[model samples]
Target: MGDLMHAVGYRKPLPVDDPESLVDAEVPVPTPAAHELLVRVEAISVNPADVKTRRQADPHGFRILGNDAAGVVVANGPNVSRFVVGDEVYYAGRIDRPGSAAGYQVVNENIVGHKPASIDFGDAAALPLTTITAWEILFDHFGLQPGDAGTLLVIGAAGGVGSMVLQLARARTRLTVLGTAGRGESQKWATEMGAHHIVDRHDLVDSVHAVAPDGVDYIVSPFSRGNIDNYAAVIRPFGHIAAIDEPTGLDLLPLKPKSVAWHWELMFTRPILLPEDPYQHELLEKTAKLVNAGKVRSTATTRLGPLNAETLRDAHARVESSATIGKVVVTR
Candidate 1:
């Protein structure tokens, strides 16, 4: 345990456009600091950020990257009382730090939550990153109050975060769920996940009209790999639009007349910067409670083998393909 542990890392950014980019290597096992928990990783989930990071990692150093992980505590830092050693936990660790694609990881106890009792480690692993993102985007950013009688639209409603958003909104809120997905498979996925109506993105406004007849009050789009201009048509007057994609330029001028609100959600914002509110972790624990009660199940559709470079790349590729609905996970 004293020696270095295994990790998935990159020596230099290479073309995922090619294949020689990511690598597996022995890396130092991090020691927990005050308020930190050193977790023995049991599972990890690959996200779009994983692929992006690999392709954009610093060429000068070994860049280790991953985001979502569920594991057990092996050690705890000083002043830590929220968890004891051997407690099973899950968290979408900070994106700025080295990742959970390793044997052990150092993460804050505040960001970590008790693993959902209903599911195993691999299934539990898929929920954290996407859950946090969907929760924040729908509730926090878009301000979709649970019973506002407002209609909520989830664009790209078949992917990981979108799927969770659909479930969470439908389960926790009274807002009518309108899911926008073009593919037949995506539409089926959305319907099964509790969407009131499924709309196509090609002609979003018309598709939305077929269901709402009026318009949606809240719209959330975590799928921004495409352009950002599409939401303007379906979004109602004074409605709110929330997204978690990159800061691509979208004309905000159109949204002004309706007093519409456009907000961005970055799940890592809280943990990466160590914001004043530590209670978000408490909220994630509450999510765990809902999941434990069997109101929700793991979104992970595919599970891979022990964490290694090849497996990590494959996970990343799965994420980047943007084909999988729900999460694709990796476990040891």
Candidate 2:
């Protein structure tokens, strides 16, 4: 319980290539508030959200910028009941708070879950954010049941969120998964993650239609900006489309003809706006059970050495490239 700890952060938004975009520093160790846990972060994973936040958030003062993390609970708030000191846990912390890219961070207990004992910190670090997003989309948004059988098309299926979407759907539902990825390695990765059919991203409509001729029953997309037409063309009437990315100038006029339902998923919503909700904790617990049972697997495809300014910068750069096949994690 040191008064201060080492961390990497930025004071202003800058390009990833800038030397000061991410810097090493020492900050006072944060103490847990009501219903919070003070974690000694052991591992962290990078996501497009990290990159987007780095580019958009002002921070004003130095601000740490990572969400997906696995670590040990070093302290807990007075009202905390879900976890205590020495407990291993994983979570995608709230975006409004200081993040997990530090030696210690405080997070609400309701949003945290026990880290699956079967996986190491790095692999466990890669699961929370993406798994929560995928789970919410499948069950909360789509209302998919375990017995319901239909086709689900996941855009950007080789990426972090997409990878989890594929695995969770396979483990929790009876949907025939169709994933969109580029040729070669990406396609292979998607298949290994449980995609029954791999649709080429370049030929979105035709590739999806080729596999599910009648049209897919549900679609989850991370990149929904330029693929709206293709989605509209390939989604069956009354089908649901859930997206996590922010697409500009998005008009739902076209989808109206098919009565397609478009849902937006932001994993941070529950943690930030509805802090009292216990569903994220419950969801992560179920996800851990699946992982420990060998039904869902970690998507940590690239390990970028240890957690530090240099390595975090490289991890951010890799995610910014928009070509990362799976999650990239950094260990302590």
Candidate 3:
């Protein structure tokens, strides 16, 4: 309803510890384009993507970097039909556009889903990005059918995306889920999220082999660079490996002998590269159903005050530390 809106963003790339890394400012509320909904963002969750983007040089002046958000629809473009004004919705928005750090953001109606009736805004905000990621990795990339019986090895299972992956794999599919977590608390969190077994990432190969014996059928590595080779070594023939992290100089040759299928899942790809693909919308809607039915739960572990630059910096630091379990959400 107002012209000015509160937003947190950065003018230049800097380390998370830098005071100027993220700054609070007032920006004009954005008008929705065709097929877009203008959302009044109520809560947002910080991901590693937020931290990585902040450290990159942005020639395009100030940039708002947040991926997951839940809010009420303030307005809708004439062409939008999936949502109406006052609808509570959640989504992992497109990276090519301005992100959800602002009080107001415009997102395509197709990529957004109705908020789950079982959760609050902060809890709902925690699901979109990670849910989309894990969903895509399982259904789109891995292509496993329901009642499919096999072992799934999820690296970084205590983190946001992996937590969702563990839950979805356990609840929807018949996959025996093996998750990795180094710390005691993290291991507990992973088990709660539905991992059948917890393996120390330090002993990834031996620990996994001790249980599976013949290697795993599927692998989802949210943070893969360090232990990718171990994954290659422990994967069964024709097993699928999907990753979300940006691992450089990865040698996939080791998988060639086993004919392993490797794929990368960037949650923004459907919204950015293939807007015509309706899978994201379907996945979000299904995820909401799962959450409402108590099949899956929100992973918002830490709430860092209100959505502001100062709090965002703290969230970024926590994510960068790579010790947090589940998702860290910031609310209004």
Return the top candidate by TM-score: 2
Which residue runs of candidate 1 sit more than 4 Å off their true CA positions? 17-19, 223-230
Worst 10-residue lDDT window, candidate 3: 220-229
Candidate 1, residues 1-332, lDDT tens digits: the string is 78799988788877654456778889889999988999999999888878887877674588778889999999999988789998999999887788988999999888889998888999999988889888887777776675656888888888788788888887788878988887888889888887888887778778888898787788887665443445566677888888777756656775676787878888888986764457567867988998988777788889999788887778777777878877889999
lDDT of 2 by residue, 68-146 (tens): 9999999888989999799999999998999889999999999999999999999999999999999999999999877
Q: What is the TM-score of each candidate against the true structure?
A: 0.94, 0.98, 0.97
The whole-model C-alpha lDDT of candidate 2 against the native structure comes to: 0.92
lDDT of 3 by residue, 1-332 (tens): 78998999999998889999999989889999888999999999998888888888582888888889999999988788788899999999988888999999999988999999899999999999889888889988998777888999998888888899999998889999999988889899999999999987888999999989999999998777777679877999999999887878887787898999999888887898888676788889998999999999999989987889999999999999988888899999
Q: Comparing candidate 1 with candidate 3, which one achieves the higher lDDT?
A: 3
Model 1: worst 10 consecutive residues (lDDT sum): 223-232
Model 1: how large is the Cα RMSD against the reference?
A: 1.9
Alpha-carbon local distance difference test for all models:
0.82, 0.92, 0.90
Candidate 3: the clashing residue pairs are none
lDDT of 3 at 226: 70
The CA root-mean-square deviation of candidate 3, after full C-alpha superposition on the true structure, stands at 1.2
Error of 1 at 203 (Å): 0.9
Q: On lDDT, who's better, 1 or 2? A: 2
